[model samples]
Target: MPDHAISGWAVVLGQLAYLLSGTFPDGPLAGAALTLWMAVLGCAGATVLGVGVAVLLDQAPAPLARAIRALLAGLRAIPVLMLIFWAYFLLPMLAGVHVGEVQTVVLALALIGAAYTAQVMEAGFAAIGQGQRNAALALGMTPLQALWLVVLPRTLRAMLPSLGNVWVSLAKDTSLAYIVGVVELSTVATQVNGRSVGYAAQVFAAVALLYFFICVWIESVAALLLAATRSRQRRPLWRYVTLTAFRLARTPARPPPTSASRGSSRSRPAPP
Candidate 1:
C-alpha cells in the first residue's frame, strides 16, 4: 500500500508539471499560442457575423424571420463535438482544400458560436422599444439612420450582458478543440495524463483553475464596459433636460403686439 501510494503521488506530480508547462518540450506558450490565437480569431469573427445576422433578422419580414429562426434552431441542435468532427473529416473532402487541426477547430467553433450569438442578439433587438425608432424617424432621419443611431445603441447596451455570457461559453467551447487534436489547454492536459499514467485528477484541476482565471478576468472587463455604457446613457438624460429648459426659457415672453395696435386713435379718426 505504501509503495502504491508513493507511485501514485509521483505520477500526479509529473502530470501536474506537464499540465502547468504544457506537453511541448519547450513550454506552454510555445505549443498553446497557435490554438489560443485560433480560438480568439474564431470568437471575434463569430461575434461580428452574429451581430450582422441579428440586424438582418430584425429587419426581416415574418416569413423570413420564421425561416431564419428555424435554421438557427437546427444549428443549435447539433453538438459542438460532432460539428468539430465533421469539419475535421469532411470539410477537406467537400471543399478540396485541406486544413490543419487548428483551422478545423476554429471553423467549427466559429459556426457554433455564431449561432448562439445571433440568437442572443435577436432577443436584444426585440427588447428595444419601437418609440425610440419612431422618435429618430420624426427627426428627419432615414430608416437606416434610425437603426444605426438609435436602435443599435440601445440594443447593444441591452445585449452587453448576454454578449458577455456568449463569450464565456465560447471560452469553454475552446476546450472542444481537443477533438481535432488542436493542443489547447485541455488537449495539453490530456497528453500529460497519457504520459504520466493515472494523474488525470491533478492535471484536470490545474486546467480548470486556469480556465476559471480567464473567465473571471473576462467578466471583470465586461462589467467595466457595461458601467461605461450606462454612464453614457445617463449623460444623454441630462442633455435632454438641459435642452428642454433652454426651450422653455427661449419661448416668446408674449406674442408680438399687433401692428394695428401701434396706430394711434388720432390716426384712426382721420381715416374715418
Candidate 2:
C-alpha cells in the first residue's frame, strides 16, 4: 500500500481563509463575514419576536390566542424562498418604499424564523404547569413579575436546544439571499469558484465545514445559556436589576436651606 501524499492543501487553505476573512473591494464585508452578520441578525430577531409572540399568545384571551396561532401557522407554512421574494419585490411596491437587498434578505429570513421559533416557544410555554406562576402571584408577585421571573425562565430552558437549532437553520438559509443579489458565503464561494477555476468542490466543502463549526459553537453557547437560565429559575435573579434601579432612583436629593436659617447660623457662628 502506497501512502498518499496530500497535495495542493496550501491553496485550499488559502482560498478558505480568503473566503472567510476577505472584504469586498467596495469595503463591505464579503463571504463568511456577511453570512455571519445575516445569521446573527436573523436569529436574534427571530428569538426576540418569537418569544414576544409566544408570551402575548399565552397571555391573550382564548379567541385572540387562537387567531394568533392560526396566523402564525399560516405564515410558517409559507416557503422561505417565497418570503424572500415577497420582501424583496412585493413589499417595496406595497409600501411605496425602497429597501436594500441585504435588509430585504435579513427581514425575510427573520420573519420566517420568527414564525417557526414561535411554534417551538409556544410548545415550551405550554408544557409549563400554571401552578408555579399562580403560586408566585399568591405570594404577592405581580402577573408580569411572576411571568418574567418564574414562567419565562422555565419555559426558556425547555426551548433553548430547539431555539439553537433554529439559529443554525437560519444561518444556512442565508444562502437564499443570492437570488436578491446579496453576496454571502455560498454566493461568494460560487463567485470564487468561477474565477479561480478548479478547487470548486474543495471550496464548497470548506464552506460546509465553516457552517458546521459555527452551528456547533452556537449549540454549545446555547447549552451554557440553558444551564444559566435553569439556575435562574432556582434562584430568581431578575429582581436584582430592578431592585438596584429602584435603590438608585430612591436616592435622596439635597434640600434647600431657608434664607432666615442661613442668616441666623452665620450670626451664631460669628459669636462663637
Candidate 3:
C-alpha cells in the first residue's frame, strides 16, 4: 500500500470530501445529495402516512381498527429488504406504473418507516389520557378541534424522541439504496475502492465517517429547530402558521361587550 494510503490521512479526508461534493460531471447529484434526498423524502412521507394510519386506527370502529392494526403489524413484520424488492420489482407489476430507482428506494423506506412510526405514534397516543378529550368537550370544543389543538400536540410531544430515532435510522438505511443502483454514499465508496485497489479499509472508513457526520448534522439542525420552536412557544414560524390556521377556523370565545352596554346605558339614562 502507498504511504499516502497509510500515513497521509489528510489526503484520505480530502478525497472523501471530493467524493461527497454532491455533484459530478454526469449529473447534478451524487452520493451525499442522493443519500440525504432519500432520507428527506422517506422521512416526510413516512411521517404523513404514519400519522394518517394512526388517526385511522384511533377513529375506526373496533373491528376496523383491529384490522388496520393488524395490517400495520404485518408491514412492520416484513423486512425492509423485501419492501425494497417489492417497490423495485413488484410495484410496477401491481400498479402498472414505472418509477425510477430513486423513487423505488424512497417508497420502500416510506412504507417501512410508516409502519414503525405508526407503532410509536400509537404508543404515544396510549400515553395520553382520554380525559383530555372530555375536558376539551367540556370547554365546548368539537372532537376535531380537540384532536387538533390538544390531543395531537401532546401525542407529538411524546412521539418526538422516537421520531428522531426513526429519522436517524432511515438516514443510515439510505446506504441500502445501493442495492437498487442508486448512486448514494455506499455506492460511491464502492466505486472509490474499485479505483484504489488494496486500500478498501481507508476508503470505506472515510465513508463511514461521512455517514456519521451527515447524520450528526441532521440531528443538530433538528435539535436547533426544536429548541427554537420550544423557546418561542407561539412566535416561531410553525407556531405562527398553526395558530393563524386555527384562528381562521374559529375565533376564541369572547365575552359580550361590556363597554358598549355601559355606554348605551349612560346615553339613555341621564335622568336616572
For every candidate in turn, the CA RMSD to the true structure comes to: 7.4, 8.0, 4.0
- Candidate 2 C-alpha lDDT tens digits along 20-67: 755666567778888888888898899889889988887899999999
TM-score of each: 0.74, 0.81, 0.83
Where is model 3 poorest over a 10-residue stretch in terms of lDDT? Answer: 228-237
Candidate 3: tens digits of C-alpha lDDT, residues 1-85: 4776665455466566546854565565778767888898998999899988887777789999888888888988887777787
Winner on TM-score (2 vs 3) = 3
In candidate 1 the C-alpha lDDT for residue 56 amounts to: 79
Best by lDDT: 2
| Per-residue lDDT over 1-272 for candidate 1, one digit per residue giving the tens place of the 0 to 100 score | 67765676667565554544454566434223444466577777778888887887878988998898888888889998898899888888999888877777777777777888899887876688788889978866677767866787778778888878877777777787777776777777677667766656655666677778767765776788788778854655654675466557757687777767776543666544
Residue 132, model 2, lDDT: 92
Off by over 4 Å in 2: 1-8, 24-26, 232-237, 241-272
For candidate 3, what is the lDDT? Answer: 0.79
Clashing pairs in model 3, backbone N/Cα/C closer than 3 A: none
Q: State how far residue 57 of model 3 sits from its true place (Å).
A: 1.6
